[model samples]
Target chain A: MMVSQRPSEVSTSAHERVYRTLRSRIMYGEIAPGQALTLRGIGREFEVSMTPARESVRRLVAEGALFLSSSGRVSTPELSNERIEELAALRALIEVELASRALPRAHMALIDRLQGINMTVAEMISKRDAVGYIRANLEFHRALYLRAQAPAMLAMAETVWLQMGPTMRALYGRLRRTEPPRNHKLIIAALKAGDEPGLRLAVRSDVTQGLRMLAG
Target chain B: MMVSQRPSEVSTSAHERVYRTLRSRIMYGEIAPGQALTLRGIGREFEVSMTPARESVRRLVAEGALFLSSSGRVSTPELSNERIEELAALRALIEVELASRALPRAHMALIDRLQGINMTVAEMISKRDAVGYIRANLEFHRALYLRAQAPAMLAMAETVWLQMGPTMRALYGRLRRTEPPRNHKLIIAALKAGDEPGLRLAVRSDVTQGLRMLAG
Candidate 1:
């Protein structure tokens, strides 16, 4: 959080630290999509060796978070509309399952927590704090999905979120900080009511309806 | 298909060549799961510098094909039962979508080709040709999903297959080879009948049923 010459050396090894730092930057939309990132540049920025930077970039590349040209130039991946649609379908399939499983487990306390985060996200949106809003909004969904106890599915869903990071920044910037959706409140109500279909529909819309609205 | 004396130096960048060679080997079950691999050892085996081998291993780490230890050591990931179930769920979601999409678009030739490959797969099993059987089995599935025209989803699915590679080898090797499951035939039949539900059921059974049998 401090503005210092040194990046935070977090609870990980150098390569992993570099990976997480770069990944957080990309996922939080600090880095623009299609901006080329050379290993040397990344290494210098992160105060890591070239090997660590390459290792970080290579990991991102295989996950489709980053793209490497045939000549080995690296940049954040740019998605076509069709690709985004497929990814959305994937999110729907996975997140709906996550939410459905989570519904039975979600408690009033959990709902309270999500509501708290949602309110914070709304405040961030009002303040035009892009990164804060993204973090809070994602935290709300993640807290909900945690109840699924499906680690792999959660991981896959987060990968989709990671890919959508830059696009999300662009989309959010276009909007004048609209209120956090009314549907999230509906989602909480459905969960509280033990309404499986209602929860499923609500969560599905929460995950995807925004994209449809954006695409429109 | 020719083996290289310089395994990781076949025209492409050394790192990429290393990545592909290791990836195909891992996916084809040539490497045993939970087997430790050192960067130096991989470099020596592939007759490349450590940089290239490190890059390849990093990519595999990204794909979840390999796992890196906290100490920076690399090994094939050892999956628990819960992890396998999660992956199976993911496979079901993706493959069902793929099979469904492939339905109306699957041409007669593609169906015929899949059937032909299935027959070869059966012959390979009867002959106790694990390698050949694996190859043919992958071909059969790839042929079917190729009709879906969703390369990104297919790639993600294949990445899952690659991660399960060594474990699959152990599983298949432990069990005596049998006649290909009846569902294999049923799948082809459903495809020919243009039966969407039948095709979905067949694909689901072809996938989940085998794992269920294994679990039992």
Candidate 2:
């Protein structure tokens, strides 16, 4: 007998596939702030039906990664300066705690992994790949925070990052930096020394400094 | 002339109505942890169609207010001890900051209103109304945090609260507390005195103390 796939199973996978791909696009800043999208367009891009596309959009909207207007228009959010500051503060608060928790558990291998990710981050900077840079930078942080054994906190931190992704892409264009963030080096050093306070400071600065400038 | 509503508009409102009502039910602990829900049941309860019910469930799942199983079952989450502790720490982190920020803006009117809410909290405790207790307790915190002018931070705080809601209801049954939380009085006093440090400590204590006892 041939294996039977139910319609719900098919739709579930399609919806999840579309949701994850679109989530990364917004989370990595591949989509710019205020960029509009339609369900039809998303369906066409993902080669999925409208139901899956609509579900994906609804999920992203719930996470604050995408905005759905009263008129049923969907777009990336253009955050106000105050909103940016609030999110930056949230990032600072949550990420700093994550780094602090990770400090005790951060082994040599994890630090080395972070440093390797940092190298990729620098290369992305040199190549002027905003999306690549953002992705690698988050990889570095996530690498450290994974050791914290605090999935809920890490999830909260990622939500903040997702919300800031589009605006961060906008900031990347403005900064035009030749090097990766200096705070990454500080973070690596603090991790090596197992300095909790230093790690907290480095993480707070790394997460908020660029965003504060953008907010200003 | 008859006014015609678009299909999308009709579905949107129906979905929103279902979502908000269910969200409050979860947030106020009217629903217990590990409580299973079905789309057909939700649709019948809300008197809406399957589409809106599914959409509402999806949104709540995204918000961490509900959990969706791999096989497509939906329920309120049954958080582990570690998850509970992490969420408690997050509540301490974000709510303390919110309270500190609101202190400068915590005028007499706001303090009076908070005291009023506190009274209701006591009444709920005496009545042994778990959901009412959680609702009025959150009303106290939310009223204070609203003056912080930090919607993102407040939203983050509320997400933590939502995650803890069912657990808090369980804790309520276990503790059999006959009075309002003592830390709340400290918070009110700190607000009246404009003591930032005191306010932060009070908020931290208020948010974490009960949860820690439960986790222990």
Which is the leading candidate under lDDT? 2
Query: What does candidate 1's lDDT look like per residue over B1-216, in tens digits?
Result: 544455544567777778888888788777777999999998888777788898889888888889889888999988888888878778788888898989999889998898889889889888876667667777788899988888777886787788777777766777674877577798899999999999998888777764875687
lDDT of 1: 0.81
Off by over 4 Å in 2: A1-12, B1-12
Q: Which CAPRI tier for candidate 2?
A: high
What TM-score, to 2 decimals, does candidate 2 have? 0.94
* Interface RMSD score of each model: 1.0, 0.6
Please tell me which predicted candidate would have the highest DockQ against the true structure. 2
Candidate 1 clash pair list: none
**lDDT tens digits, residue span A59-157, model 1:** 888777788897889988777777777777777888888898898888899999988887987788788877777778788889999999998888888
Model 2, position A121: C-alpha lDDT score: 92
